[model samples]
Target: MTFVTKLSFASGDRDVLAETVQELKDTLERKGAECKGPHASSPETVSVPQYKRLRAGDEFSPWRYDVYKRSMEIHGADDIARDVVARDFPDSIHVEVEVDRKKPLGHRRD
Candidate 1:
């Protein structure tokens, strides 16, 4: 059996997001870990409505911002994936991790 760890990162700042992902890719490569990619996604705009008063009689313009996203997968490298996930990231960046267990070809559940 093998494990594939997927990491997803998102942030309002594109520069910081790119930098963080790049650094992680470099680290994984240096450690001889099999990495899939640091795939990037199109920026997404998010809007939030604001109310001037508690009663909401008057409302301000909707606050809008762009969010950037990047993702990568560490294949069959549990130690490297664990280290990367354990490290602290910037407050502005959001990280998500998912692990998938892969069985060898023709393998079946007993």
Candidate 2:
């Protein structure tokens, strides 16, 4: 069996997000891990409505921001993937990891 680790990173700051993702890719490469990519996605705009008071009588302009996302996959490098997941990241950056187990071709359940 082989394990593939998918890592997704997101942040409101595009520059910081890019820097972080590039650093992670470089580290994985240096460790000889089979990394798929640091694929980037278009920024998403998010809006939040603010109120002047607890009541709904008054309201303020909606606050808006853009979120950037990037993703990559590490193939058959459990140790490196684990290390990457365990490492601490900046508060502004969000990281998500998903592990998938793949069975060899022609394998079947008993």
Candidate 3:
């Protein structure tokens, strides 16, 4: 049976995220593992209002930041997937991984 590993990487720094994902893809491919994609989602914009302690008026501007996310799916790469999960990622980047076992057609869910 094959397993699909879904990896989601998020970071405020776009360059770092891109580089990290690219490196991961390269490593997995070099190891003869099948990597599906590093599909990028729309950048998420988060806004935070900065309020001054003394002034309660609506004079403070809100701080806005972008949170970029990239996703990839690796199939039939249990060993590589485990190594990836145990690897140390940069502090700026956040990684999430989910593993799903592939079943035969007759055993699949509707």
What's the TM-score of every candidate structure?
0.96, 0.95, 0.88
Across 61-92, the per-residue lDDT of candidate 1 in tens digits comes to 99999999999999998988999999999999
Root-mean-square deviation per candidate: 0.9, 0.9, 2.4
Which residue runs of candidate 1 sit more than 4 Å off their true CA positions? none
Better of 1 and 2 by lDDT: 1
Q: Which stretch of 10 consecutive residues in model 2 shows the poorest summed lDDT?
A: 54-63
lDDT tens digits, residues 19-66, model 3?
999999999989999998899999999998887775776557899999
On the 0 to 100 scale, the lDDT of residue 51 in model 3 is: 78
* Candidate order (lDDT): 1, 2, 3
Q: Using TM-score as the measure, name the better of candidate 2 and candidate 3.
A: 2
- For model 1 the local lDDT of residue 92 reads 94
- Tens-digit per-residue lDDT, 1-110, candidate 2: 99999999999989988988999999999999999989999999999989999988688999999999999999998998999999998899999999999899999988
In candidate 2 the C-alpha lDDT for residue 4 amounts to 95
**Collision count of model 3:** 0
